[model samples]
Target: MGTWNEGAFDNDDASDFIDDLAEAPDWRTVIQMLDHVTKSAGYLEAPEGQMAVAAAAIVAAAVGDVAILPDDRRDLKAALGAPPQGAVALARSALARVVAPASELDELWQEGDDHDAWLTQIAALQTTLSASQ
Candidate 1:
């Protein structure tokens, strides 16, 4: 039998590292993608369960991305053309949920720390509304 070395697959060359980093979606991109999905009629009509999963993934990714950024790097107040209260609160809430160290999927799901799941669900609804235009 061949020797099994777990670290063999873990070596990341520059290109590989870049590619991996590229695959890590940005919060803005995740939000945009979810917006697109929600706008699609097929997505809107998708079963509630499917929609929920997609929404959760988007929110989780967005929260995770934002959480890693320093306060100085975040400019949502200007970019969003709105006061920062809502966005800040939303980000804070989502970050709390996304950063939990729960090891099990169910535990993560049940934690509901930041209400990221709820925010995602709301986003999906907003997407549906926008798509109807």
Candidate 2:
């Protein structure tokens, strides 16, 4: 929950997740992260939400939507080339869950002054992901 700004990767959990992706960059890693949110049964924690957002962003970037991506994370695109089959759909699903009810990430942002901005960021990521579908 150590979020600094509203951008998808502008948080501690997301930064850590990216570092982990750098080690074993692969498509499944992104899917697995997204599944943590899309397949969740109960409340989604902020860290998981953050990681999922980062994962979705990677998928978006892989499919040629790099507008929302940070410069440092862009290199990951080469390490993990084209997104896996159905990745765009999975990313879209995960993003919907991230901003939905019981999502700690969403709830936390709603409590902050920049909630609208945070939401706009997520929406942009979703829009980018959807475009590739």
Candidate 3:
């Protein structure tokens, strides 16, 4: 990374950007990726443990439904079925626990965005996580 010039304002930095976000990559990409994986016969048969969990986390985060375990999805829905809360309530609760807990994510929408900010945020979160744990 290059040192910022002293006059650099917010416009001069790409650190908080995710390049692809500038193009507004949509749910279609996330859905198609999931469709491809799930349509594969062996997709679910991937070995369990850390690797599987990690892959699932990636996919689930992309789809904005990370808190629901793959196998527990049905059970989760059933438990919430016909509850007092409405769909909006359910969605808000899920968002509160989204794997990507980012705000002003649109700030990540910069051309030539190196995504360094995301890496930095993840590192910080990991530190906070370890400290809490």
For model 3, the stretches where C-alpha displacement exceeds 4 angstroms are: 1-22, 42-133
Would you list the rank order by lDDT, best first? 2, 1, 3
Better TM-score candidate (1, 3) = 1
Candidate 1 per-residue lDDT, tens place, 40-124, comes to: 4432321222222333333333333333222442343223233222333333333333223331222423454633554454354
Candidate 1 similarity to native, TM-score: 0.23
Instruction: Compute each candidate's TM-score over C-alphas.
Output: 0.23, 0.95, 0.21
The lowest-lDDT stretch of 10 consecutive residues in candidate 2 is 64-73
Candidate 2 local lDDT, 1-133, one digit each (tens): 7878988889999999888888888888889888778999899998999999999888888886666567876778888988878889999999999998999988988888999998888888887877787
RMSD to the true structure for each prediction, in A, is 13.4, 1.1, 15.9
Candidate 3 C-alpha lDDT tens digits along 44-65: 2211111222222223332333
Local accuracy by lDDT, each model: 0.32, 0.86, 0.28
Models sorted by TM-score, best on top: 2, 1, 3
Better of 1 and 3 by lDDT: 1
- Report the candidate with higher TM-score, 2 versus 3: 2
- CA error at residue 53 for candidate 1, angstroms: 4.1
